[model samples]
Target: MSDRQAYSGMAVTGIDAKGRAAIPAFLRAALDRNGAESRVIIAESANAPCLIGFDPAYLEANRAKYGSRADARLDAGETVDANAARLAFALNDIASYDSSGRFVLPPFPAMKAGLDKTGPVLFAGLGDTFEIWNPELLEADAKVHPAFKERALFCLSQWKKGGKG
Candidate 1:
């Protein structure tokens, strides 16, 4: 329910010959600052044609928020934690970073984004989460999705409206 720290601006890196893609140092630094270097979850969502990376902090935050919501409607006799667990596991297929700082992408994401044992991938900074996209796909998505423009305009309008006007 609260705003997460804004972490943006990153460059690209290639997956090594051995399929190890180094996450951006800046991004990694951000995660480290947030105490999220130990583990990270990589998954894919349809909204973006890229691999989505989530830190434990963000995931745990989400889990807690959803858990609280679930708790509000728990059966008096039944366990309140059950609903929380169910909601938490809904997006549980998260991949974690290895000792060498790499988490393999899920099959669906790897195939969809065409990420395999060769070439580079774009790692974008998305504040609370990070996205790994194929360069082509990232470009294509940018053209079609007006989210950035819309968000900019929305922010400008909000500023003009005097913070709540």
Candidate 2:
């Protein structure tokens, strides 16, 4: 149950009208391997137009790393906006899933990621964290990997056909 366990793989699931979606079994296994609780932290990705999900342990590690960097900057006589740092880290929202891996998406973060109430949500694993994407948005993103875009397109087709995706 090391916190170093990595997340890998992709899954597509639907978000109901209540914004509830299931975490794919593969990603859930990775979280379990890391000794994570049923809760996960969801946040908007700074580098992409998607939401990122990770365990609390990883969130703490990120906070510690950012704190160290800010301290270093302060020690170097550089100006650091304490307020901005807090706000930046405050973007994360905690979500608790049931044993079946179903959880309600936080509205703000979901909306920020362009996720609608009902549609296919693609969960793509990225080692330390996973990305939650709106399949259509992902398919239209030119900066996304070709393979990912392809997968998104496939998911979109399945969703349109009334499949689980």
Model 1 worst lDDT window (10 residues): 156-165
Q: Candidate 1: which pairs clash? A: none
- 46-73, model 1: which lDDT tens digit per residue? 4766777767678778778876776665
lDDT of 2 by residue, 11-125 (tens): 7888989999999888998777776789888989888889999988887887888889889998999988878666667888999988989999999989988885787899988
Error of 1 at 163 (Å): 41
For every candidate in turn, the CA RMSD to the true structure comes to 9.8, 2.2
Model 2 CA deviation exceeding 4 Å by range = 1-3, 156-165
User: How well does each candidate superpose onto the true structure, as a TM-score?
Assistant: 0.66, 0.89
